[model samples]
Target chain A: MTPMTLADAANLHTFVDALRFIGDHPGFLAQKALEQLELSGAALGIAIAVALPLGVVLGHFHRGSGVAIGASIVGRALPSLVLIAAFLTLLGIGFVNNMVALAVLGSGPILTNSYDGVDRVDNEIAESARGMGMTGWQIVRRIELPLAIPLLFTGIRIAAVTIVATAPIAAIAGGGGLGDVIVNQASYRLSGVLGASLCVMALSALVFVALAGIQIGVTPRGLRGTTVVHDHSRKEQQ
Target chain B: MQSHWGDTLQPALVQHIELTAIAVVLGFAIAFPLALLAHRYRKLEHPIGVFSALLYTIPSLALFQLLIPFTGLTWTTVEVALVAYTLVILFPNIVAGLHSAPDEVLEAARGMGLTRMQTLTQVELPLAIPAIVGGLRVAVVSTVAIATIAAFLLPDGLGYPIVLALKEPTPFKTEIYSAGALAISFALLCDLALVALRRALAPWAARGLA
Candidate 1:
């Protein structure tokens, strides 16, 4: 139990001050975080809405899959900053512009993975579905989408991570979010910046973990059974 | 054509190309051998890969701040960050490419009396070239885009025009958008060049295209 040094006391004072600042500004931080959450959520929604349908359609019509692939490549190649600026020009900066930019970024992974997943589905199963007089939509809904779901989810997981990570850039362009807190507060209050950045990191990690959990949970047991059955049949054939 | 937007575009485009080319070439020059060394040493690979990954994960602005004490406000800071980013995308790729050479191919080359260097150059490197080139493409595009963000610290590149526009009144917003579009188009062109280069260098990988 030696006496505290001056350096130690100063360190303690800084730490206590940081804690007090956070305590006093809880609403500010929460509001910022909520804005980020809302923007991300909307972006994710729009991404899934557009990407899934486009992916499935392009995958089904495999004759011209290059179009979708080309689009995804363009999307991926375009910088998120550029996309944000483009949206800002058209929609003006705010929640809607941020949402559009993020959605465009998010679309690439989801669309590409979805196309790959559905394209890789067992062709024989699709032929069999057609042989049974099933419609194209039925074949997709029953056979293709189900089999492709896991890979589709993997794409979504990637998109989710990208959106969460890049969402902070929105703050720079006047879209309010955790990034605003980090960028603005960091100029004066280093502790606030650190706190906001930590929150962002935690949020990204949480989103990734949650998506992983959802993937594990939603994969149907019957699909595993079917995979096992296919393997068994292949072994017997050999 | 006589507007302020036009005034900003011409100089900004030149600066944009100059900065991007310098950063990309420098980053690749640094990344290639570092990747090779990391791949050669089993003990060094994981740690180096993880370190590069961690550096990449740190936000650009944070990395800038971290480097400020040593680099001050110079382009050196931005160059360091760009190079660090290239390593994250390039190292794993080179390692994977080297490892992708079939083990049997190496053994056969050795059995045929080829030395280690001979085996690497003749057998492993050719096989790895496609993947290495692919990684380079990714690295180049990523660095080009990220380099724009560096303009906040340094007064150069297409980002200068965009930042200037941001500071101006409402009527000048189009200048920002146009400059940004130009930047994106430049990235897109670089991406296309990489794809074409990859296909040209690795013709086998490009088979089935009419």
Candidate 2:
């Protein structure tokens, strides 16, 4: 079918009417979008729960970074749909499979970045921490973890955006989300698609802004100054 | 259902290979020039980056649906969307690789009476190859994996099995999961190959001494 055109305004209006009819029924656009938002949050929660500790442990071990990186690469290398399919096969369809696939996908960058952040902490600081007879956990908690917080937060932010944006794919496995609304609109030529897409975009933007605010709020002023100075020095060295 | 493994698996594998190869090649063709343009004009980088970021944010299914009106659910549509997706991964790598070349090295090349084209081709391009290839590796793996999603629109591939598995009456979901496992394994193998290739072509670069 040809794409509905501006000239087909009447048809578009009919489509809008159909969407309104669907909205009046149970489990429509607004409900589906809310369900998706919740699912996205759950998926992100799972990713952070799994990835943060793994990343910290891998960073501590040093040997495990390669393994973690490899895992992340694999996570990224797998298509979202394929992941959905794989999860669906094993777990059957619903929130669980969708959550697993999205969490897996979202975990990679977060894990990688967290590991990198911890690993890239100045060796001197770590050496001093050890020299002071600090326990391994103490060093990680006091020195490495605080220093890595900003970078780790960056990864989490990226993962949040990615999960929220891609959450619609869950609809394919019969997990309701904004994606379902988009698909429904396409199949039925309704106006709900536009509204649903707009909602998704709005949610994504809100998440991004909120994360940025959190990052700024959490960052230490001294570290921020050091980062700026470091950038300047690097530029001068170059 | 076809009982013969080769009848179902081989053709799908071959089709998967062909589709990924074509998409990677074409994606590089477009991404390289765009990267070059963005590198040349710093102002252009923002718009290009934003465009790719937006493209990256677009769900693959939604992107395919958007293209359907223009490309009619054909191989062309699938390939184009795959290429577009690849560009998002590759463009940043290419631009970063080029920019990573030391200013002194570039100045020396110019001092030696090299033209801009010659400097880019001989001096910059050679130096940037490893980084560009790193990006290409990412593109290749990503495109291969995402290519499976094209089965939703395309005629045949590993994704066909996935779709069929969803439709089948049998409880054996292994058929779909196995295909996904194979696809992921194939991606890992290709990634390893790229790593080996990078090591061979640029040992110093690989060793981080470059």
Candidate number of the best DockQ: 2
Worst lDDT run of 10 residues, candidate 2 chain A, spans A227-236
Judged by DockQ cut-offs, is candidate 1 incorrect, acceptable, medium or high? incorrect
**Structure candidate 2, residue pairs in collision:** none
Report the interface RMSD that candidate 2 achieves against the true structure, in angstroms: 4.3
Worst window of 10 by summed lDDT in candidate 1 chain A = A227-236
lDDT per model vs. reference: 0.73, 0.76
In candidate 1 the C-alpha lDDT for residue B26 amounts to 74
Candidate of highest lDDT: 2
Chain B vs. true chain B: TM-score for each candidate? Answer: 0.89, 0.91
Model 2's C-alpha root-mean-square deviation from the true structure amounts to 4.8
Q: Interface RMSD for candidate number 1?
A: 4.9
Residue by residue across A60-131, what tens digits does model 2's lDDT show? 656575666776687767877777777877788789999998999899888987887787676667779999
